[model samples]
Target chain A: MDWNAFLLSLKLAGWTVAILLPLSVFIARHLAWRRYAGKAFVEAALALPLVLPPTVLGYYLLVGLGRASPIGQLYEGIFGGPLVFTFEGLLIASIIFNLPFAVQPMQRAFENISEEIRDAAACCGMTSWRKLWRIELPLAWPGLMTAFVLTFAHTIGEFGVVLMVGGSIPGETRTAAIAIYDRVQAFDNAAAGAMSALLLVISLIAIGIANLATSRAGARRG
Target chain B: MADRPTGLDARLVQDAPIPLNARLRCEPGEVLALVGPSGGGKSTILCAIAGLRNIAEGRISCNGSVWYDSEKRINVATRLRRVGFVFQSYALFPHLSALANVMEGLGSGRNGGSERRARELLELVRLGGLETRRPSELSGGQQQRVAVARALARDPEVLLLDEPFSSVDRATRQRLHRELGHLRGRLRMPIVLVTHDLEEAVQLGDRMSILHHGQTLQEGAPHDIMARPANREVARLIDLKNIFQARIAGQRPGAGITALAWGSTRLEAGYNRRFAVGDLVDWVIPSGSVILHRRRRPSRGIRENPVHGRVESMVRLGDTVIVAVKVDAHAGYPLFMSMPVHAAERNSVAPGERVGVSLVRSDIHIMPALQPDGHDDANADP
Candidate 1:
């Protein structure tokens, strides 16, 4: 069953979401509300990973964070380990790869909050933190939930980027998707089938939950 | 510094994205209605005072507290400014219950019994039992009441209402108006209301400001502005229908008469010395001030600025009939008069019929003419 690989996959997905969700909340909010020069270009750059070949992205990550790169050397000097082919490297890769999945839904959620509602909040004497905690967070919950679920599931099922950035080290970097691929390559059909079924069910459940939340939110708003 | 500012005082000047050159003042317990046409920057003025909008150069202060000053660079954040604003759409949080929405405006920190205060506010707005219902669960009028209650929860120094009654039906608007009237008696803050409906402005405003193309042309009591607009544009804006160009023939101050040359006919008006004897001017008399002469009667009012005209159009609006008379002295100009349907029927007034009318001299207001090619005041010319 490759239990270590499956647990590692869950851990990577967890860490990726924990880091990306908070960061995406701020980024998505800024994109939704503020206007600036080159805003369209910035958005297009953020969405680049969505359409680019996973292997191409992986190659860039390899060069950008490999042992020979400055960032890779700095991390190795500080942590006594190379940046690539480690759990941390895999987590970083997962976050970057899932940027669109994590941010677009949250951006749309923030955009759905009408300008009048925000103006009313300001006029009500609510501070920035209070407005976010009391009003924005509650109203944008469904999109945030959808973002978490999609990012988690996509991170778990990723293959090309994971393989390119984190070479399949058995317990450190070999996630569930890599384990499935390894089993197929080794002619272990039974193991491959079990892992594939698990991933398929997980993805379907995630999508189903996201759809339920969005539809409920839509009905409530209606 | 001679007079301590007690309420809101603001002057805004901007050149882009809805140009504004407006200034307004309202004392405590006074309602200043900003009445203008659509796209006239009425709402923008309210937003500027509330600190929701930015003006290129301006100073806005409420109760002696400076909310925005471009020269001093002292722009206060909207949350720090104590303003209770009621938007046209209400803008209630759809996720929260009515009670929670009101509670949100109380500001965090004093937690004990804030819920009670919210409930009391709801009760004040006549939504006592519906506190737990969400905005979507309430009717449009009910939602608006909740919005008002929420705004009041801020305990603000100024209340800004932006077409608050526009979205509701006529009956609901009337009821809301009555409720607002009732509510204002207890309020001690200045209130700024923006509306395009002149009738609504006249009914609610202690003073009304007429705006056009982002400029405040005049501000005064509604009755005074309607009776005597400051200029030709204001006359047209207030729907004064009997406006015509005339030349001053003579001014007899002792007799309280200003003779105007209306084509070949000389019409007497109340003495106004603002214009010289040879000056061209524009004059207006409200429809109500144009008295229709009864058939076969030489009434004493006929001795006033009497005129002969043919009725061009007769429109019956419910109990009143509006008769547009084409004056014989001025070929293209028409004088409009309105009277009870019975009075109109008794006079046998109909289209294409000739009639005599009298323009009340005291009611005829004269203003400097606008430029021949543009809306700029003719007074600007040397």
Candidate 2:
């Protein structure tokens, strides 16, 4: 396995999560509380990538942001190159593909918080931000941790979208999921097995730790 | 403590599944028990007062400051309204310990002193040693106390309680009542307590407001309202189950007595209204106001408001004994009477035995007969 590609994969997941976590939380919180026209449409749009083939999403991004389109040309004018097959392109693809993975759990968490607690805080004269930081976030800690872990793990497993948008550019877009496929196609069964096993172990540990922490938090609430 | 504690004045209207139009007031240093049955807009009144819910019309003010004025289109947000609201569920933050829950109400203004004030409040509620426990770890009563402490930490101008004691056990409710009575003395601010329990209202309210279906039927001191409900509905709400349909026999306006025709007999009761002769009226006397005589006293000696009767049924509850007596003079319904067990023991009262029951002259109250709508005054247009 190429250590550079492995390191780049971790970096890609890290950047994708760093950008998506806060964005998803805010979006999910708004969805949980507020009602407006076209809300259902917006929600369905956000969740579409979850069920859509990653290759299809990647195909749209590849064309829509590929220098020939207005946004792509505008970006190219600034950066002197098209967005496809770039590290930045891979991050954008990963964020779109994993949007629901970051939102649904957090939204459910916020919704699950008892209205009594919210009313209590409001009546007691706490500011909205204080209520969110002091009461809501702590109580919804398990869901937040789960959302973060899932987003990170999902980004690590980017295969089709990464292939379509970031096209195996060695250090730029060769994530672990893509790297294992590359090794298999090159007829190196030993390398493919090793990469696949490593990825599986890491993903299991990430989810297991999140699950264990969530149960601990639930017990404390009891 | 505020030198001039805030009083409350509000008139709210809501046009929803059920229309509501309520007007209420409470002076500083007073507990106005807002009493009614479930779904009678008791909680709605409290919510409107605290700004937790909005009203379609009318004004809300605390002392001199107008919190909401629909005409002016000036509505203060709930966070801006200086109100301490204790919800029925005692909504304590589950993740925060008791002390921290109280401290959260102190706002960002008190950084260093919040912990001390929160501790002082917990100690006030007698939860000093258990300050570290979360709401889930505390008993229902303790959680309610914590919620109270948290609400008061803001030093609010108005206090609203939404059946704050309803969830606790009977023993805990009694303890909480005593604690609330004590708190009232120190609070000295306007309080609006929503309760479906009539006994609680009578015991704790300096003044009581009786509501039905979102409209306030009557408001006065508890005893005054109880003795003189505006209509039959108000009478029923106050647990006055012994309403008799009596007609006006004669009027002695200067003597303050309106003679009423109770089934086959005439009895004169203290009357405030100038009810004309021959006009029908409903006379009410509370069950506890009836005095049972061991034997038939002579018609001349203390015969005022006296009726010979036979005991029909008896129920003993602790120190209190409730007896139903069927009067011989009237073929009408039996009169339910409640007296102390000792009083009954002295009279040796038993079911199937004959007895004499009379009203304490001052206890007999008379009201205008029910109109078709059960309202003394004509109702609004349909």
Candidate 3:
């Protein structure tokens, strides 16, 4: 079943979620409340990954993080390694592609919060940090849960970006989706079918959890 | 109250984001009502006082401290300013219990005695036993009380209520009004109330400011503003509907009367020296001051400003009946008056019936016309 590759996929998804969800909260909050010039442009730029082909995005990231690039040179100077074909590179690719999935739901949730409620919180003598921790985070819980689940599931099932940014390397960057593809090319139909079934079950469970969170949020609004 | 000037004093002027050119002052233990139509900058003024909204040129001072000073380039953050704001929606935290909501205003469980203080505040708002209930579980009035308790927990320098009674039912609003009136006696801070309902302002405000088109037209006692508005716009805003164009005939200082020429009739009003002889002006009188002559016998008091008219329209609303009378000399315009239903019944007042009405002389008020000769045709002799 390529268990090592499956475990590596899980690890990559977990890291992507852990690093992106918290950061998305702040970014989503800023987008929700602020009004400025070119706000729609900024939002469209952030959502570019949703519509662009994964290979296209991967090509840009590959060139940007290659050994000749300034970012790649800086990373090598810090960690003594190039960044294009390792698990870390794959993690970066996963985070970038999952940005829309992580941000849009949380932004909608933050926007649903009444401005009067936030004003009342400030009038109650609560500092901005305390208000965010006590009021905003609790009210936006469902969206956070939805963002976490979707990002994890999407990162695990990613194929094109992973193949482009991080080539298949056993116990390193070879993920479950890549393993299924490799098994099919080798005429190992039985292994491919079993791994595909596992991926389907996992995807269904993640979607179910995400829908549950969304419906709960909808009920609160209703 | 403190010895020095220790209440809210603000003058805000800005062009965008809800235009405002308002000046407000409320002494400690006093309530100032900002009454105007919708989108007239009432709520914007309240927000400016709370530091929730900014102004281009203004200085807001409360309790002898500067909250915002444009000249000095100082603007205090909302939280740092000691202000309690009750929104129009009564925005209580839906997830928190009543006690926790009140405790949140006490620095969110920071003070040593916050819990005890919160409980006492809840009790003060008459929500003692409902401490464990979330906002969703409570009724509208109960939620408003919780919001009020939370607002009071911080012991703010000024209290800003942006139509706190607007969202509740009529009965609940009356009860809240009475409770707020009682609560006002115990509060030692300036309170600014924003409302579009003139009756609510009259009932709650110690002084009222009339705003229109982002400008404060006048500020005075509620009754005074109603009885004697600053201009035609103020009169119209307060719903004083018996406005008419008149020419000043003469001012009898010795008799304490100002004579006005209305069509072919001369009417007497209380002495006002501001308008010179032959000057054109607009005048208004309260609907309650128009007394109908009794059918059986006329009193000497009803002999003043006697004018004959036919009842044009009569509308009965609650305990009062509004009667519009078309004067014989000026048939185009109608004079409106409100009388008790029982009085209307006693006089047999009905549409198409001839009636004699005497406008009370002392109640007539005069102000400059908004548009010169706007309604001059209506007041011409028929």
**TM per candidate:** 0.96, 0.90, 0.95
Query: RMSD for each model, in Å, please?
Result: 2.9, 4.0, 2.5
lDDT tens per residue, model 2, B44-94: 778777777787898999988998999999888778887888999988878
Candidate 1 wrongly placed segments (more than 4 Å):
A219-222, B1-4, B373-382
The lDDT per prediction is 0.89, 0.83, 0.90
Candidate 2's error at B183, in angstroms? 2.2
True contacts kept of each: 0.85, 0.74, 0.75
Model 2, range A1-222, lDDT digits (tens) per residue? 666777887898889889998898789888987889999999999999888898899899898878788878887889998878899878878888889999999999988877767877777777888777888888888989899899888888878888999988888878888888888889988988887787788899999999999998887777
Chain B TM-score, structure 1: 0.95
The collision pairs in model 2 are none
**lDDT for position A71 in model 1:** 90
- Model 3, span B172-283: residue lDDT tens: 9999999999999999999999999999999999999999878999999999999999988888888887888889999999999999998887899999999899999888
DockQ: which candidate is best?
1
Residue pairs whose backbone atoms clash in candidate 1? none
lDDT of 3 at A55: 92
